[model samples]
Target: MQAIVVEQITKSYGAKGAVKALDGISLSVAKGELFGIIGPDGAGKTSLLRILATLILPDAGEAYLQNLHVVRDYKRLRSLLGYMPGRFSLYQDLSVQENLSFFAAVFGTRIEDNYDLIKDIYVQLEPFKNRRAGALSGGMKQKLALCCALIHKPEVLLLDEPGTGVDPVSRKEFWDMLQRLKSWGITILVSTPNMDEAELCDRVALLHNGRILAMDTPAGIRGSYERPLFAVRSDEMYRLIQDLRQWPGAYSCYAFGEYAHLALQQSLQGFDTQADSVMAELQQYLESRHHTGIEVLRAEPGVEDCFIASTKDR
Candidate 1:
């Protein structure tokens, strides 16, 4: 059985159920798989994770974790799952060690019993064991929260935006820790707005505007971007974007780093938009428009490029 199963889950809020948080989303995660729900804010990632964690019920559809219904068997499912929300929810007044011990006790397990599971992470916290939970740095607080979540050695782990507000180094370390945990045969589901992290997962589902735009391995998603794309650079970066977007042979254009990536419109009345024939004419067009030091070259599409293209309509 899959570690987690979500089938046509839908959720909404507000007086007349106006704001739709999730809309008919369905996906499953296999045991020992690291899956990512990739999207920007308000993409229903948290709602989906919360529903799987049994923190909230969906307005429609069913969800299961370890073959147990999330709503029907929440009591049993809770014990088999470890969930770390986007925000730090630890007790601020408690010491680091106290917070860990409290969560272990709540789950009917002693810290010593699970010491083997969290020793690597706990070592970093040991030096600050006496410090109040609120006194620790953002990264330390995240570590402590993770230790508490794993205190009982859950079968499935759910993390919602664990990297948000974390330093780049800490984020890298946290992802490394997750890779280590995966070796122990634990299923992990992580949600994040960061597109770069999506490539690290075994597979990802692109979420946008309360819906999934695409679901595939990182390479597969990049491969699906069928358009011919070019990275364009000129002295006037801002003006280049405006001109590219208005260009007759441009299918899609958007800013990417220092260049504006332009997707070619393959078929145009008088323009040969193919990569081989378009460069000279395109350069001349820019030159005619008074763009200096213009450089245009074919570029490989990354995950972010595919995402922008996928959700451009919505």
Candidate 2:
């Protein structure tokens, strides 16, 4: 069964149509799945999430949560959905326990009644139960927010960039917690800007410029990458990039990590081209100009590389 369904959803702001936050986005998440929307800022991820949570109305199209219309059945849907927005929206004056209690009260429940639902997470916050919400660390605040979101035992969880401001270790831990939550049969839809996080999802939709570039498992997305790629590094990195871009045999070149990833244009001389040949020519060209420390080798493309390549094509 589909936990959430969005069909041709669109949202815009300003009289001149200055911003098109979401543009005809259509997607669905299966029940009990960990789905991810991977994209950088302004990719329409927040807009889509708000629409699905029934917090904001779409300018066009329709959305449903568990076969119930988001617009027409918003009151009923609210009781079944948990949302953690991009920004931490908890009350600053409230204590950790108070915040959780407040949210539970809003949902017509008490902490003890649904304590089992958030027990694992709430234990970590128990030490800070009496502390003000605003005083917690970024990671701790994230944990507290999550506990509050799940307090009501919502069937569908919508998290927007839950790890954006947290430390690397905390980010990993948060994802691990999410995996555990998935086993409890809750449908999760998370949005994130980190490419590494995308691989954690059962399926991911790559959003760029308010459009869906691709949607598939991480392995499937990586398998779609074509063309041989090589990483090149030299002492004269700046000059190398400029020169390589102008090189007749180079199809594309861009900075990646400590080296530049390059896609070479196929040889027109009907000769079987090899990495050695390409490196030899590049080395000679640089050496004649008094350059040194040149290194070139074939490298596997990663998720970021694929994202860049796909968005560049669009």
Task: Judging by TM-score against the true structure, name the best candidate.
Answer: 1
TM-scores for every candidate against the unseen true structure: 0.94, 0.92
Per-structure clash totals for the candidates: 0, 0
**Over the stretch 79-163, how does candidate 2's per-residue lDDT look in tens digits?**
9999999999999899998899899999998999878778787888899999999999999999999998998989999999999
Winner by lDDT:
1
**Model 2 spans > 4 angstroms off:** 265-273, 283-290
Every model: Cα RMSD to truth: 2.5, 2.6
Candidate 1 local lDDT, 140-177, one digit each (tens):
99999999999999999999999998999989888888
Total residue pair clashes for candidate 2: 0
